[model samples]
Target: MAQYTFRTRSSDCPYELAIGLVSGRWKPRLLEVLKDETLRYGDLKERLKPVSDKVLSAALDDMTRNGLISRTAFAEIPPRVEYALTPQGESLLEALGPLRDWARTENGR
Candidate 1:
């Protein structure tokens, strides 16, 4: 399985590249909204309404494959699954805090 990384490009600023890694239309929202909790697929889909099922699935897969999120599958009569941030993901969220704050103030939110 191929994994994603921000270091793939050599010419870009490291910070910019790092920021770009989570710059997908839904990725930053996913990370921010999910920062405080673990969520099942259906719950996530509901919370991220307006996003197509295919796009959400692809974003989750990319984050999971890249080690940013951990997916737990439960075996039951009906299978259940959940997603939560990994240590790396938590750290990334912390790193984005200042940027988020800056944006908020700049936009007068």
Candidate 2:
């Protein structure tokens, strides 16, 4: 696994910081999936079919580090892990509503 750091200079725009956090093929989709429900690793992997384990893991790690998602691991015998959006993530989703709506309208949906 690679190490990802979300770095921002003092002059960096707020939009750039926000975009940097969620800028990825899987990050946005991962956020969408965790928007309403908490799911296990396997469940998330299943929902995001065709996504490689490496990419999925990286995305989850990045989101976790950025404080957009929370990861919980249980101490059970077999081990249990779950993922869900954080409050910050929920706020981001709300902020993205206009963009989503614009896309929907553009697609005539």
Candidate 3:
């Protein structure tokens, strides 16, 4: 486990806590991509084409800080790093299913 300073008062409200965990430009999209398998930084960036490096990096960092994702760095001459959902993040994805279904219903899907 690691400690971090949250940008919001997450401990004060459940809504804030939930939002703070996943609200960002590319968080939901990133989560969807990571739901199935682990991916290296380059692979993730490729899958998330059109997302600038800065944006993706920030999103990954925020998610990592919140315990939503785990980052594994490998030692090698050319470094390799992989990102995957943590248990908490998998739970978040499971919780999102109903919300997604609701949105689809609203959209008449």
Candidate 4:
């Protein structure tokens, strides 16, 4: 269930205040993968390397619903499909900079 919070100023739902769309365990990893380029479903699943089909499918649906990612389908005999991040999602790359800086500053990796 979704939790509720109140704003004495505007009184909006926390769902709208979410941190730039990527959430849950698999999502961040998915974004990391997509940062390079658009990819096919099989390529993503292979890069994720152990995620189950059901979990990945659900994650993809969630991202698409949140407007963080785009899915394109092509009309080929085999049906080509690819996934890429939206400009909104691309904007989040900068927001995650601090964490990357911290990881390097602390872990030295």
> 1-109, model 4: which lDDT tens digit per residue?
4554322111245544544355567887887788879999999999997999999999998787766679999999899999998875676666666766898999877
Best by TM-score: 2
Ranking the candidates on TM-score from highest down gives 2, 3, 1, 4
Name the runs in model 2 displaced over 4 angstroms. Answer: 1-11
Where is model 2 poorest over a 10-residue stretch in terms of lDDT?
2-11
- Candidate 1 global TM-score: 0.83
For residue 51, model 1's alpha carbon misses the true position, in angstroms, by 0.9
Off by over 4 Å in 3: 1-9
Minimum summed lDDT over a 10-residue window in model 4 is located at 3-12
lDDT of 3 by residue, 1-94 (tens): 3333354324656655676677776898888999999999999999998899999999999889878889999999699899999888898888
Better of 2 and 3 by TM-score: 2
Model 3 RMSD in Å is 4.5
Best first by lDDT, ranked = 2, 3, 1, 4
Across 22-77, the per-residue lDDT of candidate 2 in tens digits comes to 78788888889999999999999999998999999999988887789999999998
Q: What is the lDDT of candidate 3?
A: 0.84
Residue pairs in candidate 4 whose N, alpha carbon or C atoms collide under 3 angstroms: none
Off-target runs (Cα >4 Å) in candidate 4 are 1-16
For model 1, the stretches where C-alpha displacement exceeds 4 angstroms are 1-12
Q: What is the lDDT of candidate 4?
A: 0.76
